[model samples]
Target: MTLDRSRWQPRTTTFIVLMAAANALLYHAPLFSFAADHLEVGSFSGILTLVTALVALFSSTALLLSLLALVSHRLLKPICMVLAITSSIAVYFVATYQVVLDRTMMGNVQNTNLAESLELFHPKLLVYLALLGLLPAGLLAGVRVEKSPRLRVAAMAASVLVLTVTWGWMASGTWGWIDKNAKRLGGLVMPWSYVMNTVRSAAPKLWQSDVQILLPEAAFTDDEKSVVLLVIGESARAQNFSLYGYERPTNPQLEKAGAEALQSTMASSTYTTASVRCILSHVDSSSEFSTRYEPLPSYLQRHGVDVIWRSKNTGEPPIQVQTYETARELARDCPGPERDYDEVVLTGLEERIRSSSSQKILVVLHQAGSHGPSYSTKYPIHFEVFRQVCESVELGTCSEEELYNAYDNTILYTDQILSRTIDVLKRIPAASPLLIYISDHGESLGEYGLYLHGAPWMIAPDVQKAVPFIVWMSEEFTERRNVHPAQLQAQTAHSQRDIFHTILGALSIQSEVYEEEYDIFNESFSNR
Candidate 1:
């Protein structure tokens, strides 16, 4: 049965319409599913609203595709193929992880290093690409389109007017409902979600100044040696930590070492880049380039304080410091199996502090803690206190218990690392050490069908926003600063924004930019 190849060819307008319909139907399951779950399908008004929304979505997509296909005969097929392939990839992540491709999430995608991105690879992803991407793309490649530019242009203009009227009518009655779910709805629309958001996230970088606005001049209040070790944890949620009343003993080492856990603390954002910037910024500003200022590390370094940054993770803001070391760089001095883990960041830490000539020192250790879907691989085998852990990157394949055990073990490993760090600080009594640990953002583990972080912050669950804030100070540090552990722990309700001012207060650095109200250690204690 031989078929004529000429029969398969269609006009440009027809091809665009078919492609738009295919994309709306095939790649929009998540959007329609969300709509179905929220709308009252049993009622007439809800059904009408749903139908109108669907029509709007289809029409808008068709109009956009029509414009692209009509622009040039040479580039029509290539554009369609690219959209097909990219939409398939976008839908896979949106549906599998239940993540929204908002600006922050898109920023996360751009900021992800190759090693971190590789963790997302799974067999299911390949299946999606083959079926949804390559199949359509291959079909588009073989089809010949008959050009009818004038007719297509006329049809598209009519569509634009019709769609505009239809949207205005729909908005009069359903604007509130649509506005409420705009973030989720915008994030679920295939191709446009990642496409527009990537631009939205990257556009700000263009206007940002190359040089930071330097903060007011600061001076040390005392000549005493002070070292603040700020450990920026990655994807660590407070809900799982035993220190925050979790049933599991995930914080055994931290508890034994007498670390103070502040109960009320929320992350500023659900993603690392924004949350880390907030943690370092002088003010509690939204994730916008307009509010850019000197980060804590750079500000401290400029004030003659020795600042050393050790990172096992990416996504920290631009920093200006004398010493910045990555895990691979630090691996030379560190040996054995633990060297590959986050414990590698602690290589020669005590030696560095002892050898420093500055009276004030700040060492920032950015940890790759509990980054998901390969949680079981994050810690050593000995740290796997819980049994029957999930080893697969496909999170949905694992049972609830398996997923939890693997994630908990990472927290347990984190407990050990923090404890070991405390031990090192304890040995350096002359430096009057202080350890402050807080996650850049929290993680979501099968909560409300959400697997990983980076949902829009307004709608993200508490598990994704609530992070652990732990502090450990030596007796010398407490005495020199005239602060008590009980007083510090008693005053609750903290946030990542407080970190900037708290570090300044602890180091006794006087600056006009330092806000006393934001400093957690300044409740009743005086640094004078």
Candidate 2:
């Protein structure tokens, strides 16, 4: 008993070191894999290089927290407690889902309201949070550590000073190389990646003005009855869609519905918020733009088009429009689950379409299609054609086959929702209704050991860039816009940038802001 107690060790520093080691080993297998795959240790001299490269994976966070622990004896316990909870939650999610906690995802988490965030919680998550965070935090609560505050503060300062001096000296010659790689290294560290990312992501939005650019007056060219429905799909890659030639019947409904499968269409960015904004903005893909910038919706509304943005996606808000409906808000009137699926956006939409006697109308339905790591839940039970799905948020437990099945099912579900949307639009007799469905961006399903979307646009994979862009316009609508389906289909390459101008051209809404070069249908329309 005495030997066991002695071996167990009562030191807080020792416990922290052991915990850090365990966390690094268990939750950071991806970091080890990355280092091992990339490192070229040809000789003894290269060993130090490899170790130095992997320091962020194993020792960086540990060293930082250890020094911080010495700051104040009074503050140490609470700091450690908070770190324990956050680390557990962070590590569990990243390891299980095989996701990188980047700035975009952190922003999404921060921007999500309480009701939307609540959707992430389940019994499985509760269990993980308890075991990893609450359990460890509870253990720390019972432990008592004595320290001299003045002496500890001095020690912490000394430790930081030494670390800074040594780091600068060692990194001086290779400072540029180190600086370039620091961001990647930070992303590899367990818990800190998510913890710091969450803080950083929220930082931008806090100071950012919600005041969108409100335009004065927008006028239609003629009294043409047209209603353009622009549906934005989320996290749906073109590779998985059968319409793009995948073997699976993922897009059976859309294929039968005669939706024009755009060839070689790509997204502006690999994320929802960025891609959606870019698609809506007048700026071309060649030009750079910030996500906070809003123009498209406001432009349409100002130019006298009845514009409305309805969404179920997190972090996606209306662009300078009063007529915006969230899933929860729609659910109160639509009569379904608070946030069931993409179809929820369709609820009460037909009525809105019928009521609107406007010459030109634009409705943007933002679907939560194939958004991970809960793909199975996005679709109804009937649409679960692809069986043996990975239902758990911890996708690591599921096989690659299961993950594909789950994701594919969501795609199939998206197919149904889109087809149904077209059916609803068909009811509009007077208006030349057309439904343009395009995904914001694509997703990675265990590709190169990466899962989900939001890789940096500069280094993003084709799966993250290649998106589905489909056009389902009625025969009357096709004639009204002077669109040659053959020419539209023959055109090989396309992008999200074309969307802003194409809509303006299609509706014959002439504005100085509309660039003909960016409009795909401009060439087809000889009238303009």
Candidate 3:
């Protein structure tokens, strides 16, 4: 069929040109520039370098193929549309992932609501709208010129012109954004920067340096022997088990053990890095720790008592407190036979407990707790406690029952890990004094359109943040280290800020840095 020449009008040409120009300008700003700024990665040199490299690759491909389409009438429009749309989507996903990393690192695992995330980069919204408008305009123009060879040629010419201009604008902005954020983005590589940003943004609260640990003078006495074990669970949201009043019986073992389980009712940050960092450090709700500085592990090691960090998650290693001291005292990280079991963590724990040369050792167990989209992987195969669980990730298509079953199944496995751990602790020759367990943070299971945990803090609630804290005190701990049950329960109301001091206090370690202002064992909880 002969091409229709009549459809190629000045108006059509203008529309194509404007659409392409608008799309390029809008998409690049947020995808590249805004991302750098939000991540505090400085300017164009910082965030755009990686994006520039990627866009350059894609742009070259677009230009080469557009040229090919330039020669063949059959290929031009399809290739151009494909390149433009796909590249735009790619930019969006990259920026979204960075935001996800930012929250995740901060111990938030819940998904950020679309509206809130969009607000953070509102300047880029115009670009997204512009591109959406262009898609239909581009298609209509191509169709109008289909029957006329002359008009087809004219439309193609206009389309390419628009592509060139739009592509240039996006490329240039990417470079400029990178240049602007160069300082902030300095030394931050992809994925790592994304990961750290997530952790940094999700930091809960940090206590000021003024907070002090009020310890009795000459606190050390051979007469008093105390042991405290702090088992830190990773990505463990508190709302998914019977122990936390989850509809399902995910914690039958813990329930049977009769441990005093308390579930907090607020949403904390959304990631292990931020959640644990905040919990382990003496940080309070008012002050945010400058993760860029102040490594917490060193602070713990400076005082007496042994500090051990055992990690199964491979994202970022815990911030180092003191390299030399930690190296000598740290528990070896055995992430399991595969990325799949909670059992691997309990392996060396018992040995470390019994063989400890020090009277007071702080043991940190980081579990692969209920990390979703792959819940089945978090447990031992033998447990198989729940069936019909979500075995795949075609999300939304999976039945609610299936997804929940899979999630609870992970919890079931977690219970086994806890049970076995308790049994081992009970067997520890009554030498150890106490075992305290708390999750790094909580998870969300399809609550408020939230599937995973890392939602933005301003929007996330207590369920996702309220973690489970349990005290497994032995007879020795009760006689020597225990406070009144009433006071201990009241201390549960204390923020995670006290975790650092409570551990030190339970061990009877004297450190000037420990603060009664935030310490759980402080006489404050006693209302004395």
Best by TM-score: 1
For all candidates in order, the CA lDDT equals 0.86, 0.73, 0.54
Model 2 off-target regions past 4 Å?
Answer: 1-30, 40-50, 53-73, 112-132, 142-183, 215-217, 284-294, 320-322, 332-339, 524-528
Q: After superposition, how far is residue 22 of candidate 2 from its true place, in Å?
A: 8.0
Q: Number of clashes in model 2?
A: 2
Residue-level lDDT for 36 in candidate 3: 43
For candidate 1, which ten residues in a row score worst on lDDT? 519-528
Task: Give the CA lDDT, 0 to 100, for residue 209 in model 3.
Answer: 45
Compared with the true structure, what per-residue lDDT tens digits does model 1 show for residues 1-528?
754567678887777678767877889888888888899977876777676666667777777777776567668788879888998888888888989998989999999999988999988888889999999998887788888676765586577658767676855676677788988999998878888899999997898777888889998898888889999999999999999999999999999888899877999889988899899998775745425788999999999999999999998888999999999999999878878899999999889988899989999999999999899989999998898999998898899999999999999999999999999889886888999999988898898889989989888999999999999978887787777877876776888888998999989999998988788778743322
Model 2 residue 169 CA deviation in Å: 7.0
lDDT of 1: 0.86
Best candidate per lDDT, number? 1
- Descending-lDDT candidate ranking: 1, 2, 3
Clashing pairs in 1: none
TM-score, each model?
Answer: 0.95, 0.82, 0.59
Cα lDDT tens digits for candidate 2, 1-528: 223323333344554455556566645666556555655556543455455544434455556556666654467668767876776666655555455677766765565566545645556766667877788778767766544355544554456457655755774544444456555545657677877788887776688777764433445678878888998998999999898899999988888988888888888877776677777877754453444445777777766678878888764545666488888788877665524777889888888988876788899898888887788888988888998999876666689999999999999989999989999989988788888888989988877766777775555678988999999979887787677778677678888877887888767777667677767766732221
Q: Model 2 — TM-score against the truth?
A: 0.82
